[model samples]
Target: MSPPEHRIIAGIYHLSKDLGRHFSLTDINLQVTNGEFVFLVGPSGAGKSTLLRMMYMDDRPDSGQIVVGSFVSTRVTRRTIPGLRRKIGIVFQDFRLIEDRTVFENIALAMKVTGTPMSKIKQRATKILTHVGLYHKRHDFPKALSGGEQQRVAIARAVANRPAILLADEPTGNLDAVSTRNVLELLFKINAGGTAVLVATHDIEMVQSFGQRIIYLENGRIARDHEKIFVGDVRDRMDESRVSRRAEQLSEYDIRDEENE
Candidate 1:
């Protein structure tokens, strides 16, 4: 196993809502190692988004702590939060691109805020836009692109700084099947390049075939955390009917049984 510096560690964390009427999340403990691709899956209100937020330091845990690289939640201050965020990339379900900015500018802005040199910003932004297959539309505003294209640009912006970890929340929620596949493929490609990727989503059928580590969240707690086992090429299992059948099989496993209990 790698040392703590190479992992995202959450230590017995807890959080609640509505003045403690109910716990939004509790007893959460997990670690994401550098360059690993993992999925955080659960139904809505399962605290998936909240966990991501805490990892990035957007919100602090009510108890315990989270450590991302060298930054520790127990020691982080407002003045240092930006420094921590620069080491992590974040993507949202809704395309959060600035409507008024061109695709190139949207990506460049991310680099610019981090004080990247202008020459390098132009160079990196162009490379990322081309990598995402949207260089041709670099001058177009967000509204000018299709939904899939917009999401690709959002991904480009998210990773513009080359962060060590990328957190994506429900990245395919609004896309049609084809677009969803495309966006997920892009994420896989990025992960292959050695950036740790953690994606949160409620759509289990879309991700079960990938054979990656999956941490199942239910009622604000982790129900299961383990790598999935699949036979043959994962791509071969991606057909709709096959994935649906696999999902059915998974429901009989411990994760689903715990959910029922």
Candidate 2:
């Protein structure tokens, strides 16, 4: 295994949030490793959005800390927040593209704010727009596009900087089934290229089949953190019949253990 410094992408340690009479989050602890894809699932009031905000330091926890790359929430300042945000890509359910800007300008703006040179911005924005299948619509404004196309543009803008981590909150909430699938495929493609993705959604059924790590939040607390297991190819590749039988036995034991618990 790699060292913690090399492996971990984001870490939340004993974080909590208080919204006066109601608690938004309580003692939340979680870690996302470099290049890992994870889902944060819960009901609407489960503080999923709050946690994502905290991770990006748009809001700070009442206690404890959040560490993303080398930026620490406790130590980060107003002037440095933009610097931290540059390392993270954030996507929202609502397509937040500027109505007046063209698709190309929307993406280019992300790079521009970071002082990326005009030539490099044009090259990177063009490449990202092509990747998202929106190159043809580069000159079109947001109001001229459909909901799905607009979301794709939003995603393109989010990743224009090639951030280390991507935090998406209900990215598919407003899309139809087909559009949702297309958006998810885009996210998977981004993840495959080595960006750590932490997507927060209330639709468990939509993401469960992907076989990635899932953390379940309920009432501002983590109810379960489940990791994926590989049983398909490993089971089929067993050298001997007895070994296969042994694997089956172990599987049975695991099931029984879960039932007992």
**Model 2 lDDT per residue over 219-260, tens place:** 888999987544332223333323334445656876888999
TM-score of each: 0.84, 0.85
Compare the candidates by lDDT and give the number of the best one: 2
lDDT of each: 0.81, 0.85
**Candidate 1 lDDT tens digits, 55-96:** 898877877678887888989999999988888888988989
- CA error at residue 57 for candidate 1, angstroms: 1.0
Give every collision pair in model 1: none
Backbone clash count for every predicted candidate, in the order shown: 0, 0
C-alpha RMSD between model 2 and the true structure: 10.3
Q: Give candidate 2 regions above 4 Å deviation.
A: 1-6, 230-261
Residue 51 alpha-carbon offset, candidate 1, angstroms: 0.9
